[model samples]
Target chain A: MIPYSKEVLQHFNKPHNYGKMKNPDGVGEVGNIVCGDLMRLYIKVAKDKKGQEIIKDIKFETYGCLAAIASSSMLTDLVKGKTISEALDFDRKEIVEKLGGLPPVKIHCSVLAGDALIEAIHDYFNKNNKLIPEKLKLRHQQLQKEKQAIEERYKKDKAV
Target chain B: MKKVYLDYAATTPLDSEIKKAMLPYMDKEFGNASSLHSFGRMAKEAIEKARQQVAVFLNCRPDEIIFCGSATEADNLAILGAVKIAQKKGLKPHIITTAIEHSAVLEPFGQLEKEGVEVSYLSVGPEGIVRVGDIEKVLKPNTVLVSVMYANNEIGTIQPIAEIGTLLKKQSQKIIFHTDAVQAANYLGCDVQKLQVDLLTLSGHKIYGPKGAGVLFIRKGIAIEPMIYGGHQENGYRSGTENVAGVVGLGEAVGQIQKTKNEIQNIKRLRDELISNILQNISKTSLNGSREQRLPNNANISFAGAEGESILMALDQEGIAVSTGSACASGSLEPSHVLMALGLSPEKAHGSVRFTLGKYTTEQEIAYVLKVLPKVIERLRGISPVK
Candidate 1:
């Protein structure tokens, strides 16, 4: 068995931002079934007192392992109530640190959580016709490339 | 917390009676079997007695059983030893094995393949059962081995070992047939002559015995090279001082199986109940291997939307012990090669959980698992992104 941290187990046992969220501002679905991980994160964005957009609510539905789900759960907590910039700046490292630390092999789960956040923000920007950041564009391209690699590996495995 | 252990297929607890049988060897009677002293003779006597007991269990001669470190070593020695000797005889050797065999068996084949031996990994169907025709399909004139497992460790599907042995008998006597019977030794009676296997691997810990003991049944007249070298113990097939206590524990454990034969039926009953209740009560759940053709103690299932590790963690919190074949559950990123060989989707493979029952497993414990599992599955499904 992979030695999961207590926090990871707790979040996996009863994930906070779990379940399918209905009608969100943006939905970022990342990962794939073939790779054995998929995360669909939903966010509702509203303006604060200073007229700056802030995340009002967040939820996630993950089809993955314990670390994946826990990472997704932790992502929601860290990004909620933050402005768009703050949410994008939310480090995958912070997610790992807050979770007490995941097994080295499962660190990909945290990277995946960050990727889903970027995808969600990209979706949010796409929805409002806002200008996309170059960083977001680069990450989006990277995600697509990673997805193809996963699919290619899957095909090779199936062939085997 | 109400703790329940249901992972006997992984390894079983040491049986107390077997422990008592090993105690004297570990304490007062401790000695090197190779020494000329009386203590050494006593240890040698115990070692020889253990060998005799294992021989009786397998229905082979006492000299045929070679005590090894573990089943992994037995498997390595059996495959590498047999294949290497065949190669040494100046014949280009070809070997056949199922894709779903334990890594122990497969790794040696890989090693042989690197040494220019033609190796065929026959794929099993969705039921995780390898067919005899598949072996015949790949049977080359120079084929030296047909090393399929007696039963799978993950899915617990029993292969047609005796039938394969029979087929090999028709083909040629030159071809050595081996089976890793580690998972089947507890529930199934292994008569080496009846099975017609030239080599068979057995482990102690998988049964109610100590962890360190293992046996390789080398049918007499099958000359093979040794994997280890030093003290020339285990008939020089394996070297170094004998694991005296482990051999005694294994002997006592194998002996206990005959007396506890009826307990197999009880274990099957509990397994059936656990399997039935989980399949019936949990929606979107499916059994992974052949429902009827599996080991009496095994019930491997997949919950569609819930990943295996998530479900395992939930069950762990509930104080139940089980094992999962999910990629995430394993330290590696790769999912179970056994489940994947069955052509299950990666999702299903990542969700597979094996619940193996033991002699000590009771109906009440099965009921408790049935009670907790449905809720766990529902919770995970509720959180799952997959529809």
Candidate 2:
């Protein structure tokens, strides 16, 4: 069994803002079913006092190990009140540090959380017909490639 | 909190009676069986007695049972050795095995395939059973052997070994039939003649015996090449000094099973209750293998949206020990191949859990597990994103 930190277990047992939001402004779903880790992130955006678009609320649902669930829960807590640009700058490393660091095998869970946030931001931009930045587009393409690789590997393994 | 162990299919706790039977061999009676001394005779006699004990359980000749390091070695010897013997007769050896075989059998067949052997892997149906007709369709004049497991380790689905055995007997061509009966030895009667098997494999630790002991039953008049080339122990079939203490424990364990056969019904009743409760109380949960054809002590179920590893960890925290069909526990990210071969979706396969009862499993332990399992499943399902 993975030696999960007490904080990670706490978040996993009582995750905040779990479940789906009705008609959310932005949604991001990532990870593969074959890899046994999938996360769907939802965000409701609103204008703050300065007329800057900020994440008014966030929720996540994860199908994976303890670390994956905990990472998703922590990611929602970190980005709830932050501006869209500020949330985009939120690093997965900070999530890991806050969770007292995940096992090496489970570091991918933190990365998944980071990727879900980026995809949700992209969804927000796409909803408003705003141009997606080149860097975010590149990262999305890379995540797509990783997903294809995992699917191909799963197919080959099942064939064997 | 009291601990409840339900992972008997993985391995069982060594019975105290078996330990007692092994103690003398590990201490005072430490003479090599091959030596020409009085001590050697005593040691040799004890080895023969254990062999006879196993033979009585298997209903085979004492000389036919060859003790090896493990069931893995026995499986390797049966496949590689039989194929080598067929190769010596100027025939291209063809082998057939089921997809659900343990890695011990599959790896040897894989090595043989690399060495230019014709090998065919038969697929099992959703019931986790290989149709005898499928085996018949693949058999050829040069097919040297057919190896299938008697029971699956993950799902505990018992195969129709006797039916397959009977079909092979009707074939005009001589095709040696082998079954890895390691999982069936404890609860099932393994009469070689009645099963019509040419070779069979049994493991010690799986039957509440000591580890490092295994048996490969080779019928008389069958010629096979030896994989190990050293001292001509066990009539040159398996080479090395025997594991005396382990063999004694294996014999005692088999003897105990034979003596206590009546207790199996009690275990079956507990297993039935556990399965019915989990399926009835939990939503979106289903059993994996054939209900009627499965072992009496086995219950393999899958929760729709929960991940198996997380459920396992939660149960571990609650002092209930069980095993998951997910390969992640063994440091692999893939789900169970057995569950996959049974046509389960990857999500369902990844969420499977196996609970195998034992001779000592009681009603109270079953009730405790039933009480705790639903809460764990609900907890994991709440966190799952698959819905």
Candidate 3:
């Protein structure tokens, strides 16, 4: 068994912001069984006093290992009530760091959480017909390509 | 937290009596068995006694038992060693084995395939049981060996080893029949005549004996080309200074099994209760493999919405040791090959967990597991993206 950090085990044992969010402005599902990490994020968006969009609430549903679940739960805690732009600045490293550390092989799980966030924000922008940010678009495009390769790998190995 | 070990299929703890039997060989009597003096004679005498005990346990000739470092080595000796004799005789070898064999058997066959020897991997049905007809379908006149496990390591599904053994005997006097009986030796009380196998493998650590000692029973009159060469130990079949203490431990363990053979009923009762309650208390749960034809100590289950790794981690937190077929748990993206060969979807395989009982398992431990398991499964299901 992998030696998980105390923080990681705590979050995994009782993850926060883990469930469905009703009437959410956006939802994101990323990763797949092929990579051994499948996760979905739900977010509700609202306007702040300054008329800039902020995340009112967030939640996640993940089917994965300790690191994946811990990363998902930590991602939600990191970005729950932040402005959309601040949440957009979320890096995969922060989750790994906030959890103290993760195994090198499991760093990709944190990336999944970050990718799911980008996907959720993109969905929110598209749904509201808001001007999409350039950086979010590029990240979304990369995520799509990565997901396509993963799906192909799944198809290739299904014969086993 | 109270720790409960339910992963006996992985390996068993050393038995106290076996430890007592092995102590002197490790210390005072540690002389090399091949030396030319009283020290050597004493060590050699101890090893011979261990051999006779194992022979009695398996009902084979004492000289037929060869002690190796581990069950994996024993399996390699039985499979690869037997085929080398056929190679020397100038016969093209065709080997038949099930797709679910341990890597010890499979990897040797794989290497043989690369060397242009024909090999057939027999598939098992959803019950994880191999049919004798499948072996019959693939047997060729040149087939050298047919290796099947007496019971599966993962799901604890018992295979029809005796029937398959009988089939190979009736088909061709030339075909060598072998079974990896590492997991079956304790509860099954393997009698060589009853199993009718020309070659068989057993392990020490899997039956409450020390690790680093294993047995390969090769019937008399069957020839095997040795893999390792040196010191002329183990009839030149295996060539290392004997693992005296480990072999002594193994022999003691085997002797204890013969005495406690009837205790299997208690393990079966505990296992049945565990399986029944897990299914009844937890929703969307079902057992894997054929219930009636399964190992008495095994109860592999799949909880529909709970991912195996998460459940395993949760159970681990509560100090319960078990096993899972999930990809993440193994640090590999592939689910268990044995479960896949049983025709389970990858998702179902990911949800599967193995809980094996042993003689040490108590009713109180079972109750505690039943109490903790449902809550953990329910918690994981709540977080699962599936449902």
Candidate 4:
């Protein structure tokens, strides 16, 4: 078994902000079942006192190893009250740091968590008819390409 | 907190009795079995005695048992050596083995295929049992050997070995039948005459003996070319100085199985309870192999929407040891081929876990596992996105 940190185990054992939202403001789902690390992010966005958009609530559901689940939970906690732009800047490295650390092989899980958050923000922009940021648009395309590559690999493994 | 070990199918702790039997050889009686002195004669006698002890379980003669370095080597000697001998006798060498065989057996056949040997890999049914008809359908005029494992290491599914043995015995063309009984030797009776297998492979560490000791039983009058060439030890079949201490430990370990036969019922009861409780208490969980046809000490289950490596780590944190089908545990990225061959989807295969009981496993340990397992499943499923 991989040596999981105490904080990772805590988040994995009693994950915060789990389950689906009744009607989420923005929803983003990433990963495929074949890759064994699918994740879905739900966000409730609200305007703050100064009328700036802030994340009022966030929840995540993940299907993968301990590191994947811990990362998702930690990612939700990291971006709960942050402004939309701040959450966008919430990088994978910060998720690793918050969860203590993840193994090298599980670093991709933190990446997945970050990707899901970005995709959820993109969904918010698309639903509101706002122009998506150039950086997020690029990240979106990269995630799509990665998902496509994973699906192709799954097809090849099944063929074998 | 006490640690609970439930991965006996992988390997086992050496038995103290076997250790006691092996100490003299490693210490004072350290003479070469091939020497002519009195010390050498004593060592040779001890080796022969061990041979006879191992032979009793298989109902074979002492001379028919050839000690090797490990079960993997024994499997290679049986498959590669037999095919080579058949090729020497002007017979076209074709081999048949199941898809779920251990790497020890499958890799050798793969190597043979590269050498122009026609190899047929038989597929198993959903229960992980290879049908006798499937083996019969793949038989050819030049099929020189059929290798099947008596039981699987991952899922603990017991194959139809006796039936396959009988079918091969009825064939007009001579085909050497071999079974890797490394996992089966713990609970199953290995009477070769009853099974009708020409060659059988067994491991020492699996049966509570030391590692570096194994046995390949070649029936009388059957010949296979030697894989190792040296001082003509093991009747010129496995040519090297024998690991005398390991051999003695293995022999004593096998001999103790008969005395401990009654403990099997206890293990089976605990195993059954574990299976029933996990299936009953946990939702979206399913057993992996044929429940009735599996090893008495094994329970392999797949938890939907939860990855196996995560479950294994959670259980490990609780001081309970188990195994998972996830490739991450083995430092690979692919799930187990055995679970995949059973027609499980990639998701289910990735979610599978195996719990194998052993002679030393206690009822208290099973209860503790049962108490902690459902919570772990719930915790993981809560985080699962698949639902």
The per-model DockQ list reads 0.74, 0.60, 0.64, 0.58
Question: Any runs in candidate 3 off by more than 4 Å, and if so which?
Answer: A34-36, A133-135, A145-160
In candidate 2 chain A, where is summed lDDT lowest over 10 consecutive residues? A151-160
lDDT (10s digit) by residue, model 4, range B1-387: 769999999889999989999999998999999999999998999999999999998999999999999999999999999999999999888899999999999999999999999999998888999999999999998988999999999888998889999999899998899999999998888999998999999999998999999999999888899999999999999999989999999999999889768889999999999999999988989999798888999999999988998899889889989999875565556788899899899788889999999999999999999998888888888778776
| Clash count per candidate | 0, 2, 0, 1
Best by lDDT: 4
Return the TM-score for each candidate structure. Answer: 0.98, 0.93, 0.95, 0.91
**Candidate 2 overall lDDT versus native:** 0.89
Q: Write the per-residue lDDT of candidate 1 for residues B1-387, one digit (tens) a residue.
A: 888999998889998889999999988998999999999999999999998889999999999999999999999999888877987888788888999999999998998899888999999999999989888899999998889899899989999988998899898547899999999998787999888999999999998999988999999988777889888898899998999999999999888889878898898888888888888878878899898888999999998998888788889889899999888776666789999888888888888899998988988898899889888888888988886
Q: Model 3, residue B159: what's the lDDT?
A: 84
| Superposition error at A132 for model 3 (Å) | 3.6
Instruction: Candidate 4: give its CA RMSD in angstroms.
Output: 2.7
DockQ, computed on Cα atoms, for candidate 1: 0.74
Ranking by DockQ: 1, 3, 2, 4
Report lDDT (Cα) of residue B155, candidate 3: 87
Arranged by TM-score with the best first, the candidates are 1, 3, 2, 4
Candidate 4 residues A1-160, lDDT tens each?
Answer: 5687899999887888999887888999997777667899999999999898999999998888888888999999989999998988887799999888888888888888999999999999989999999998998899889889988988887787
3 versus 4: better DockQ goes to? 3
The prediction achieving the highest TM-score against the true structure is 1
lDDT of 3 by residue, B1-387 (tens): 999999999998888888988999878998899998999999999999999999998898999999999989988888888888998999989999998888888898898899888999999999999999989999899998999999898888888988988888887458889999998988785998999999999999999999999999999988888889988899988999999999899989998997667879999999999998988888888888888988899999988777788888899999999999888887777888888888887777888899988889999999999999988988988887887
